[model samples]
Target: MGRIIAIANQKGGVGKTTTAINLSACLAEAGKKVLTIDLDPQGNTTSGLGIDKDELENTVYELMLDECSIKESMKKTDIENLTIIPANVNLAGAEIELLDVKEKEYVLKNSVDYIQDDFDFIIIDCPPSLNMLTINSMTTANTILVPIQCEYYALEGLSQLMHTIHLVQERLNPNLEMEGVVFTMYDARTNLSTQVVENVKNNLDTTIYQTIIPRNIRLAEAPSHGLPITLYDSKSAGAESYRDLAREVINRKDV
Candidate 1:
């Protein structure tokens, strides 16, 4: 079975979607079958891989709401071994609609359970909030990959995120574990970036991946062109960093 990982952070502009898109592409480049689930309503992950939202009939929303099967929602991306469960703006309503439903928190988990063995990795791009959708992503994932931006408030809101993870571990998914905290949008020339990295390393219990994703124009521009960094500019620094990230993730000790 594939390892189900949720790329999550409550704070926006943390490079969550960028990490999701590029890492999946790199993993597929290494010959691993990767399935990316775009759980965020923004649909950035969907468009990042060249999926048009207007052309979709079913999406992660339908799968989570149990209106459609997960297999039915899967779509091939431009990358050979990478597939995506695209999300659209309609997912914004899922949080409220799923609230009154039975096993509301496990909706995503249950939906993914049937198709766990289909890929080598299932990476979920979670919404930038600690809402029911994020909870569902946590419950569905075996491990959570947090992408922390190297900024002054890098650790801000992390306590709340950890608390939610603890609650989920205690009462929902006992097998759930933190994969690691990845440093994203790093500027090597800045002292503040160094300070944030030092603080994060000193505090977090999880392993910090050696590959730090530097802030690059290519990384930011790739999504606009509906492509991963690897496809957008294979020779770029952004592409190399994501490839290294994919290698680190694949080599890490499984929980």
Candidate 2:
């Protein structure tokens, strides 16, 4: 079975979507069949893979509403082994629509269950809130990959996220675990970044990936060009860090 990992962070601007896009691309580059599902209504992950969100026929919205089969919604990306279930603004209303469905939280899990074995890994990019969409992602995922930016307030809202995860583990998916925590937007020149890293290591019980994503211009620029850093500028530090992170993830026994 493919390991379903949700790239989530309740805090926005934490590099959650960036990690979701690049990590999956890097994993595909490593010869693993990877599928990324954009659970965020913003559809940034969909566009980051070079797919036009406005041009999509079938999206994650239709899949969630039982309007289309999962296979019909899957879009092959420019990357060889990477595929995506694109999402759009239409998905923003799925939460309200799902309220009337039976086993509403598991709708996503049930929808994608049959297709799990086709990929080596399935990564989900969750919204910045702990809403119904995020719950569905957590319920379906085997583990969650958290991307924390190197900042003073990094640990501010983490407790609530952990509480949500604890609730999911207790009532929804008992097998759910934290895949790993990754530090993003690190500035080596700043002592604050170093302090944030030390603080995170001291505070969290989860394993942290050693490869730190620096504050690279290429990383921020790649998304605007509708491409992953690997495709946009492979030699950049952003691409190198994500590739290293992929290797670490592949080697992890816990993943």
Candidate 3:
């Protein structure tokens, strides 16, 4: 079965979507069949991969609320071997609607079950909240990839996130595991960034990924252009770092 990894952090601006988009692109470029599931209502992942959100007929919203099959919602992207289950604004209501529904926690997990064996990886870009949407993402995921910004408050909301993960492991998906933590927007020129890195390493049990994504204009520009950094500026530091992250993920999985 394919590994389902939820790129999650209850904190925004932590490079969650950036890691999801670029890493999925690099994995596809490396000849791995990858599927990206946009669980965030913001639809940033959908647009980042070059999929027009307004034009999407079926999305993760439909799959979750309307009981639509994940297969029908899957859209092929510009990158070969990369597919996406786009998320639109409609998903914003799922949080409230799923609250009292029976077996609501497993909706996303059940949707992905049918296609679990079709790809090497399923990366879900979770919403930046500990709401129902995030719970669904957690329930469906086999591992969680956390992206921590190299800043002062980077570790502030982490305790709450870990507590939620523990709850999910105990009540939802016991097999769920932590993949690793990635430091993003790292600036070596700043002592604070270096200190944040050491702090995260000293606190978390998970290994820190070696590939630290530097703050790059190219990475920020690619999202507005609706393209992954790999396709927009392959030679940029942002693109190369994501490619390295992909390799590191593969290598660690092999071990």
> Which candidate wins on TM-score?
2
Give the total clashing residue pairs for model 3: 0
Model 1 TM-score, 2 decimals:
0.98
Model 1 clash tally?
Answer: 0
All candidates' lDDT scores?
Answer: 0.93, 0.95, 0.92
| lDDT digits (tens) for residues 1-255 of candidate 1 | 999999999999999999999999999999999999999999999999999987899999988888888899999987999999999999999988987999898998888889899899999999999999999999999999999999999999998899999999999899999998999999999999999999999998887899999999999999999989998999999999999999999987665
TM for every model, in the order presented, reads 0.98, 0.99, 0.98
- Give stretches of model 2 more than 4 Å off: none
The predictions' CA RMSDs to the true structure, in order, are: 0.8, 0.6, 1.1
Q: Clashes in model 1: which pairs? A: none
Point out the worst 10-residue segment of candidate 1 by lDDT.
Answer: 246-255
Worst 10 residues of 3 by lDDT: 246-255
Q: Of 2 and 3, which scores higher on TM-score?
A: 2
List, residue by residue over 152-226, the lDDT tens digit for candidate 2: 999988989999999999999899999979999999999999999999999899989999999999999999999
- For candidate 3, the per-residue lDDT at 160 reads 96
lDDT of 3 by residue, 209-241 (tens): 898999889998999999999999999999999
Q: After best superposition, candidate 3 residue 137: deviation in angstroms?
A: 0.9
Candidate 2, number of clashes: 0
Report RMSD for candidate 3: 1.1
**Global CA lDDT computed for model 3:** 0.92
